[model samples]
Target: MTIQIIVLATNEKADAVIKQGSLAQMPSLQDGWRFDFRKQLKALKHATAYILVREDSPEVIEGCLIFQLVDKMVPYMAFVEVAPHNKGDEKKHDHVAGCLIAYAFKQSLIRGSGRL
Candidate 1:
């Protein structure tokens, strides 16, 4: 029941897109989930399953996506986007963020499903 969480690099301000708290809070991401930042270059070496992306936008810190891979394949995932203080633009960004995550997951499944 081990889960690997991977964060992707974004084009925006690196510090803003990659939150230190999120990286630190990896241990709290659901039960049996492990967090590995890019700094830990060797973490991927032992990964049997992968959640290719977990991220939040700069506009809101509450959006997150958790993609799960079971038996070396993505079975399902959860995407959440929250608008802090009901900000309209932030809400839109949250939706886009969720959609982006879902699209990536779908693409990964399409690419990996046949191989497995």
Candidate 2:
């Protein structure tokens, strides 16, 4: 399923998307990502990952979220990170983390017992 949601582009002051992504599309440490997502994904069986990318440039990931349903009952966010360019003073986008976090909540609601 292609779950596409909007984010804010700080530079252009427009919207972007946080879509469902694959393990194959995971970023590497060399890519300036702080975490080793591949290793995390491999270790966590319950993990469900998503990536944030531009609506126009889906090839470039702006952020990511790793959500886990703990014991099939509790909603847990294992990890969440914005891209190197999406952080600090030189950031290109805004609300990257917010979008991912909201998506996590949405997932929790969808997968949970319909109660937050």
Top candidate on lDDT is 2
lDDT by residue (17-47, candidate 2, tens digit) is 6676788888868889998777787788678
Listed per model in order, the count of residue pairs whose N, CA or C atoms clash below 3 Å is 0, 0
Show the colliding residue pairs in model 1.
none
* Candidate 1 residue-wise lDDT, 57-91, digit = tens: 33334333344344555444433333232235322
Task: Please provide TM-scores, in order, for all candidate models, with all chains considered together.
Answer: 0.34, 0.83
Give model 2's clash tally: 0
- RMSD in angstroms, all models? 10.9, 3.2
Largest TM-score belongs to which candidate? Answer: 2
